[model samples]
Target: MQLKEFSFICPVIESAVVLKAIETVTSPDAIAQTLGNTDSVEERKRKLPSQLVVCLIIAMSLWSSDSMGTVLKNLVNGLSRQWTKLGQYWKVPNSLSISAARQRVGCRVMSQLFERVVRPLATEETPGAFLGELRVYYSYR
Candidate 1:
């Protein structure tokens, strides 16, 4: 309405490409391992498996503006990658189902996944991360 109210918003990039990047960073095996570590592995296949739920959580960050149902639909529908079942699983679950899946997986899986993958991004040679010749200790607390 007003010139002062105008805001610039960044456009979303291709969904498949972003999903592939996420797959690269968080491989299937790594996800399964984290699930196992958290004792959250599913006993049998379901509408939404544990692994997909894990990925769904990551995808949620990328599609933060969209609803969970829409996000999951985009995530499942955009899997052009050859490794996945793709076309066979186009039937996206409803929001309540997704919520239940999220509940079943619980928070421990994500916490364990974070503990598994997240590490120091800086090496010993980085400028500000280290002192002149010694490593600097940075604590969050």
Candidate 2:
């Protein structure tokens, strides 16, 4: 609350968008191939496809919270460009829809995708990353 205290605080700025980082780490095409979750089935008429759902799940993991709906809305706001490019206006799916979509993708597929995509985000020099002689990695999610 004091001017001297304020002067000691440095302004932090984010130089990257999370969606861009996600795209660099993994792509929808890759997820589709991994899960066989292509949009080939025209009869389902699902607004939320398996690929997008997979990304949403990953995004949810990144921006973790007690509420899935909150995570999804945040994902939508963060990755608005990707959704807008799909030729349809995107809206955050309801809890039921999210559940259904997740079920449609199946837990097995998600597990596999997570194994394939998730990686250690810390460098060897990061604090407390190693205990004794063993190398350690931390997962934020």
Candidate 3:
């Protein structure tokens, strides 16, 4: 039996796709207003800025099964050029940093963000989306 050649290559994601999803969902101004965050005051800083972290959180949610680092890896790999232009050097934070950033961003902000960004997929065209003016629940999972 002949062995098949395998090559590993990750597809690049356009900045517009990711940014558009975020723009539709949440904005930097909205997040800062919600979180009451001020501009960075530290003289020295690490790679994981809060704004990037927020985007990372969304990406992580989209890819729930992947480790945070893996999710970040795929996202950064896909958007390397854009990230570079933004003066961001892609470095996946350790698990501890992820935890801290989550806290720093706050659960309330994230919750409100989800409420605003995430909407019911049901529409008039979808079956039973509106049953006699009462909404239908789909996918209990």
Q: Which structure among the candidates has the greatest TM-score?
A: 1
lDDT of each: 0.77, 0.63, 0.60
Per-residue alpha-carbon lDDT of candidate 1 for residues 4-120, written as tens digits (9 for 90 to 100): 232224354677667767766677889889888888988987878888898899899878899998888887776545335545646877888999999999999998888887666
| Candidate rank order under lDDT | 1, 2, 3
lDDT of 3 at 18: 57
- lDDT (tens digit, per residue) of candidate 3 on 1-77: 11112111335444446545554456666655655534332234646656556678778776787798887676666
- Ranked by TM-score, the better of candidates 2 and 3 is 2
Q: Which stretches of model 1 miss by more than 4 angstroms? A: 1-13, 80-83, 86-89, 122-141
Which candidate would rank higher by lDDT, 1 or 2? 1
> lDDT by residue for model 2 over 95-124, one digit each (tens)?
999988887777777777678777665456
Worst 10 residues of 3 by lDDT: 1-10
Off by over 4 Å in 3: 1-20, 37-46, 78-88, 119-128
Q: Which candidate tops lDDT?
A: 1
